[model samples]
Target: MFFRKTVPVALLAASVFAISTPMALAAGKGEMFMGQFTTEHGTTSHPMGDVHARLNPTTHELTYSIHWSGLTGDVNAAHFHGPAAADQEAGVLVPIDGPYTSPLKGKVQLDSQQAAELEAGQVYVNLHTQAYPNGEARAQLIKH
Candidate 1:
């Protein structure tokens, strides 16, 4: 029901987490994901960015990093929106706080439903800016 990516970063993190977090190791290997953000996918053409995320199935922990560039205005907000197909839009599933600057890093523990949706590649990361109050850039989550 879960697909694990044996990327070096994931493997290395898994080893480290294994030492202090046996449950994480026992839960299983982490799944790696990538998202390429662009204005074309959003409601308007005003910003662009990239997002990286890892999900530890056993722990329900979602670790993420986002890099944004070419923003037309200040980043007003960002979130992990979900359960939508590539061509559709959906409600917010997780709120992402900042270091509003580039290379944002954080983690959130997901609920069972969210975890399932993530594993099924139904979630996405969206960056919003003042110019595009709705959304400036968006990237659909997909297992890497």
Candidate 2:
């Protein structure tokens, strides 16, 4: 299998996505999740979108997929935030190191503690950037 570490950046991103297919098939179907984020703009106005996710329990990792319209800028970063409440979601558990392209794709490698947070239903994913000083979009996560 070609991991990002073994390939050129362009090739790496491609392979990362390609590898997921079989890995997806081998593992039990991951839980499907969806969320609505208020965003830094206050979740009260303008345009926004949803977040999609799949968790690989065995790897203790989560794939966050974000899609939005009228996003002010390119996606600068993505993250998993939480330890908050149902409508009061909190901080970030993982900082997605990215120069993310559209769809703002990335992987979050969770340690035992992060995994625990997710299983506890206290985690979510968010998209951030310059234009979206607060946030461009967000999706609160829940196991399906």
Candidate 3:
């Protein structure tokens, strides 16, 4: 009877400890923030498919990935729009992968400050193709 009671208690304690461990760990336990957007040229409505950004918690460095099949015309510029929500106005936060042509690929590197915004969920990713030339896709960065 004594052995049975002690074993059960020990197991319960171990289980509780395991459950709490992930939350307490901060170094390698950072999260990924993600979002996406897309647009075509000469159209007020920008809706293609979506784009994504995978960000590292500790470094703030980011890898931007975009794929909006519906985007057309051409792109002019792409940037990080900030401090706002979708359809809620626009703010300049940082820059995306860039110096784009067309038939774009989905990858770019962000600097330190841009990475900081990414961790804070304040930054957004924008893409411009030769067709749109202004901005064809956009996605906000948020902890995922």
Best by TM-score: 1
Residue-level lDDT of model 1, residues 66-102, one tens digit each, is 9888877777799998999777788999999875788
User: For candidate 3, lDDT tens digit of each residue in 82-105?
Assistant: 665555446566555554544344
Pick out the ten consecutive residues of candidate 2 with the lowest summed lDDT. Answer: 38-47
Question: Model 2 over residues 43-63: C-alpha lDDT tens digits?
Answer: 443446777777777787777
- Candidate 1, which segments miss by more than 4 Å at Cα? 1-28, 40-46
Cα lDDT for residue 73, candidate 3: 50
- CA lDDT for candidate 3: 0.60
Cα deviation in Å at residue 100, candidate 2? 2.7
- As for candidate 2, its clashing pairs are 38-43, 40-134, 40-135
Candidate rank order under TM-score: 1, 2, 3
lDDT ranking of the models: 1, 2, 3
